[model samples]
Target: MARVVWHVPVTTSGPGSTTALRLFRLRDGRRCAVGFSSPAALAALLGPDQAHTELGEPALHALTTPLGVDVLVLDPRLVAPPVTAPATPAAPAPTALLQHR
Candidate 1:
């Protein structure tokens, strides 16, 4: 089976918490769970209404409803490092006298 990855930032509502929901294709097929840092975070990301439904549902109807693929929550460590540039100090604004008034 091919391995695909999905990434989403956690919401402020659910901090320092994580959750995982598993999905299976076949009765014995490899199952995978999609994890969120927190329920509030997951809810914030997926929307409050959907979050409630997602937790209650067994197979996560939304995932299969849109596509036949399962939803899996992976560890944050598994995610790729963010691509960013080093922060640089801002240059001081030119003095008013230096401006061409």
Candidate 2:
């Protein structure tokens, strides 16, 4: 029987561009890799537009271990607050200039 594969996120600059495995940092500043059990699970945390690939558990570890990333976070929970747009000040109305006679 084949081993269960996990969904691993990847980043690509554009079409036909080389892809790189997306790595994450822990709260302690340690680097680690992330994997999800399914595509839906991956999308839920990273959004629907996230790109991902499938790999077995061993393969995921092998790829990350070489980069000093030994930890693997499976189905991680959201710990940080959601990002919001900054409030911008409204622009002042334009004033008409008087012409000198």
Candidate 3:
């Protein structure tokens, strides 16, 4: 039987570029970024494979909906972060004025 995989977040320290969020999976305590996708809101649980970082057309519609039969397991850690009030924009810099004697 295939080992159960747990979903994880792609925090700052996690691998993968900002263009696509890093999809992590914890199998038997070992964490690895299995894939990356921008459109896919949720990460899919695949049998431990390296993530595809290439910036190209996504052949697969969604991570969970692969080409054929797939196993997807959910974890509690995949919760949306708490919403916080937006920060106020900084004030513009002062303009320089020249004085002639």
Q: How much lDDT does each candidate structure score?
A: 0.44, 0.92, 0.38
What's model 1's TM-score? 0.26
Best by TM-score: 2
Task: Tell me each candidate's TM-score.
Answer: 0.26, 0.77, 0.22
lDDT tens digits by residue: candidate 2, 1-101: 96888899999989999999999999999998999999999999999999999989899999999899999999887889889776897678989999999
lDDT tens string, model 1, 1-101?
54332333322346556543333233456444454545576555455654332232234445444455554443323334678876997788887555565
Which regions in candidate 2 have their CA more than 4 angstroms from the true location? 82-101
The candidate 2 region of ten consecutive residues with least summed lDDT is: 82-91
Q: Could you tell me which residue pairs clash in candidate 2?
A: none
Residues 1-101, model 3: lDDT tens digits: 54333332333435543534344345445333333333132334222342333322222225434433133333323444689876987678998999999
How far is 55's C-alpha from truth in model 1 (Å)?
3.0
